[model samples]
Target: MISLKKNEKWFWSGVVFIEMILFYSSSMTYKQQTSVPFLERYLRNKPLAGSLKHFGFNYGGKYQSIENDGYFHFVEFFVRKGAHFGTYLALGVLLCLALYTYFQKNNFLKILVPWLMATGLAAFDEFHQGLTGGRTPSVVDVILDSAGAFTGTLLVVVIVYFILRHKNMKKT
Candidate 1:
């Protein structure tokens, strides 16, 4: 596989900006339907319609049958309801961007700055939605969104550390 590119903060920022925006929006949609038969209800509703469930279908018709496999079912279920899936995807992209910037020493302020910004931004988005006619603000969604950033950041740290160690080993 090809190695990650260096100092691609601008690239990552744009991607994170877009992905997290969708993540934040999908999260709001997910939050709006969190209750008994949450996924089923939301999947039937507009904006987050049943069509979104297709994302988890990497193997076409076979994987489309979420009922047969536990993991695939959960994946489809989340695609059908939870915000965690979007959270993880956006955060993973953010982490890649973060690593590129960090290595280039261009990640100004502190490393946690992006993470905090993402969390705060999502919280703000939810707050903004609260101002709308039918939308409501949710603290739970913000927490989950922040946790996504942490999960991604932690993964990046561990993976990068191991990669560096392996490179040093190869030189010895």
Candidate 2:
């Protein structure tokens, strides 16, 4: 096992915690995870409903398409997919941070490792969903999750590059 500094420990812990949440959420049925009722209660009263009404897309799931699912389900589909993106984005960041101590000078590995790991987790999560009732494993969701991880890792890479450049400049 590799010895970790205090900050690295925290970062690794965050990665583990996030992974646990992803796994736990994946084990649940779609109905258990639905936030549609909650969204309808609050969002319908807000001015955003008018703008959201025109925003439409077809989610061709096993049950029904978005056209048959109506407005609230359409919104819920986006919300659910957004959660997938955001959660994996966070996982990518945490994984990158945790691995930074080992890969500080290796830019390629720094970005690649975290993204691959996060994508692997996304794939695993989708597989786990396949085991749950009312849940469907989707390749599109895995792709979306990968996109999120890529965006996150790229963000970290860019930020670290600038920080390192600034430090080197100050040494002159």
**Best prediction by lDDT:** 2
Q: Write the per-residue lDDT of candidate 2 for residues 92-168, one digit (tens) a residue.
A: 88888778767866889989999999999899999999999999899989999999998888888888779878988
The list of candidate 2 runs beyond 4 A from truth reads: 1-6, 58-67
| CA lDDT, every model vs. true structure | 0.55, 0.81
How would you encode candidate 1's per-residue C-alpha lDDT over 1-172 as one tens digit per residue? Answer: 0245544655467656766565455446434643435544654543433554344453322454333543334444445334543564366446545555444453332236656766776677667767655565667667766777666655665666688789989999
List the candidates' TM-scores in order.
0.54, 0.87
**Candidate 2 lDDT for residue 164:** 72
* Candidate with maximal TM-score: 2
Clashes of each: 0, 0
Q: What's the CA RMSD of model 2 in angstroms?
A: 3.3
Candidate 2 least-lDDT 10 residues: 57-66
Q: What lDDT would candidate 2 get against the real structure?
A: 0.81
Return model 1's CA RMSD, one decimal.
Answer: 10.6
